[model samples]
Target chain A: DAGVTQSPTHLIKTRGQQVTLRCSPKSGHDTVSWYQQALGQGPQFIFQYYEEEERQRGNFPDRFSGHQFPNYSSELNVNALLLGDSALYLCASSFGNPPSGYTFGSGTRLTVV
Target chain B: QKEVEQDPGPLSVPEGAIVSLNCTYSNSAFQYFMWYRQYSRKGPELLMYTYSSGNKEDGRFTAQVDKSSKYISLFIRDSQPSDSATYLCAMGPSQGGSEKLVFGKGTKLTVNP
Candidate 1:
């Protein structure tokens, strides 16, 4: 089955700009989550969307926001991006609310210059 | 201190060797543990998932969780060059995938052929 798919494999943005990254969950998956991974670090949870509603969130600020669609697709939007925001944005999908194993996409490499 | 602590090891070993990766968490409520593999510029691929304080095995990979100690581990057997990648440990506190996953700084490994 097709796994999670992310768009614009790479991106470059200036400081204070905004960026939107897209993700399509795997077939039959119903939940989507976003994560950020800095260089030499592991993925940090941003938020999770289920049933088109954000069900859970991490410690990140409000600048990092996300939306889930009816088709189970998702979008991660960052506002007023800072250089520190430059990292790999990953989207993962699972089947249920408390999914056991999540499928991940190759992720969007966001570079805030 | 960080919620999850992992040694970001650029661990190197020869092929056909055994590799052990580990992570420790400060949260006792973490109910699910997972290991993910990621190559450069790629999203993390789930390697192993386990709940409870025991061991689970899949092919050449094994995962162990010690809830009492709040430690989790992933072991790769007969490693190959293809196994070379960054290994990340993630945990969820509430009902697994429905909640946010806290991740550790990945451990980079290079299996030399």
Candidate 2:
């Protein structure tokens, strides 16, 4: 079975620009979550989309937003990016109410220049 | 203080040695614990997960959780070069109503031949 798939493996954007990263969740999964991992740090939770709506969010600012489609594909959009936003954006998928094991995609490397 | 604290160890050890990684969490509500392994620039791969205080063993890797002390540990036995990666400890409350995970900074281990 295919696992999660994320688009735009690598991206370089300038400060103040916007970027959209996409993800196709693993087959048989219906929930999508986004995370940001800086160099030498673990992935930090961004937000999670369930039932095509955001069900939970972390401490990220409003500049970070995401959407989930009916097919369980998701997109993470960052507006007015800053250098600190440069990191590996990861998309993970699972199917359950809570405490499900997440299958993660390779992730998109966002470089804010 | 950070919700999770871990020593970001670039620990070097010889092949076949036992490696221990640990993380301490400050959240008392956390009940679900997990360990993830991540290679450079790659998303984290779930290693093992345990709920509450108990010992879980999967092949050469073992996970232990001490809920009373708010501490968790991952032990790798007969370590191999392939086991060299950043090990992250993640936790969340089982009843907190979301799959959001708080993660540690991760411990980097290098097993030499």
Candidate achieving the largest TM-score: 2
RMSD of 1: 1.7
Q: State how far residue B92 of model 1 sits from its true place (Å).
A: 0.8
State TM-scores per candidate.
Answer: 0.95, 0.97
| Local accuracy of candidate 1 as per-residue lDDT tens digits, A35-78 | 98889888888898999999888879999988998898999999
Docking class of 1: high
lDDT minimum window of 10 residues, candidate 2 chain B: B92-101
Q: lDDT tens digits, residues B32-108, model 1?
A: 89999998888899988887789999999999999999899999999999999999999886443347788899999
Once superposed on the true structure, which residue ranges of model 1 sit more than 4 Å away at CA? B94-98
List where candidate 2 sits over 4 angstroms from the true fold.
none
lDDT of each: 0.90, 0.92
Which RMSD values do the candidates have, in order?
1.7, 1.2
Candidate 1 residue A63 C-alpha distance from true site, Å: 2.1
- Backbone clash pairs for candidate 2 read none
Model 2 interface DockQ: 0.79
Instruction: Output the number of the lDDT-best candidate.
Output: 2
lDDT of 1 at A49: 92
